[model samples]
Target: MKEKVVAINRVAKVVKGGRRFSFSAIVVVGDGNGTVGYGLGKANEVTDAIAKGIDDAKKNLVKVPLYKHTVPHVMEGKYSGGFVLVQPAAAGTGVIAGGAMRAVFESAGIKDVLAKSKGSSNPHNVVKATFDALLKMRDPMQIAQQRGITLSQVFNG
Candidate 1:
């Protein structure tokens, strides 16, 4: 699986002796074939935190519906203070997004898309919002089936 480290934060806690420091990592992982997941892990060391994150992400893997190297339709997602809007783009447009969102897209094997994150720049919230948007995506064929119509009828109508 391919993995991207979206953020690593050094957190400190006050103790009797002094300040104790730990590392927190947020990571995204994928098979580069429409499966992706995100996780957050904290540990005393960066490498350990990253490893834990990868394991957690693998457990949360989700399959994304892809069409022509992009999302099938427009989507909006929100998590706490973060909001994200994702839409399909032309084949050659490439992934147009910011830091946290880029990692999620690349991991999900999205080659073309237009995404915007608003309300908060925090990686954690942005990633969650992006996931929400992706989880809500529905392929046209799936929609047609759910509506008891043929795929062609959906687009034709």
Candidate 2:
């Protein structure tokens, strides 16, 4: 598994010594095999922030069901003021996403997906919304089981 830093922000706090500066980072981690996660970390240094972010991401890992390099159906997720729409794409269409969403798709090993972020452009909110959508995904077999029906029955009926 590997981790990627999606964004880094510098924050400052007013103190007796004028200001104290810190770093905040957004990180995505994955095995490129249907598992992915994201995290936010704050620290006094860049390296520390990134390391913390990766560690946090590992703790929040999520499994994404892949269907021929794409999702099985279209879905939407929302967090705060951020909204994300995700849809399956044909082979060779490639991943159509931007910023945090792109990092998420790549980390999840999604080769063909169409995604758009709406409303808020904040990286934190966007990442959260993307994860929300991925977590909402349901596998066909799981759905069939929940319905007490066979896979073939699901397709035929």
How many residue pairs clash (N, CA or C atoms closer than 3 angstroms) in each of the candidate models, in the order given? 0, 0
Model 2, 1-115: lDDT tens digits are: 7788999999999999799999999999999878999988999999999999999999999899888889878999999999999999999999999889999999989999999
For candidate 2, give the lDDT of residue 85: 100
Identify the candidate with maximal lDDT. 1
What's model 2's lDDT at 28? 97
Candidate 1 C-alpha lDDT tens digits along 1-157: 9999999999999999999999999999998889999999999999999999999999999999998899999999999999999999998999999999999999999999999999999999999999999999999989998999999998899
**TM-scores of all candidate predictions against the true structure:** 0.98, 0.95
Candidate 2's C-alpha runs over 4 A off are: none
| Model 1 score (lDDT) | 0.96
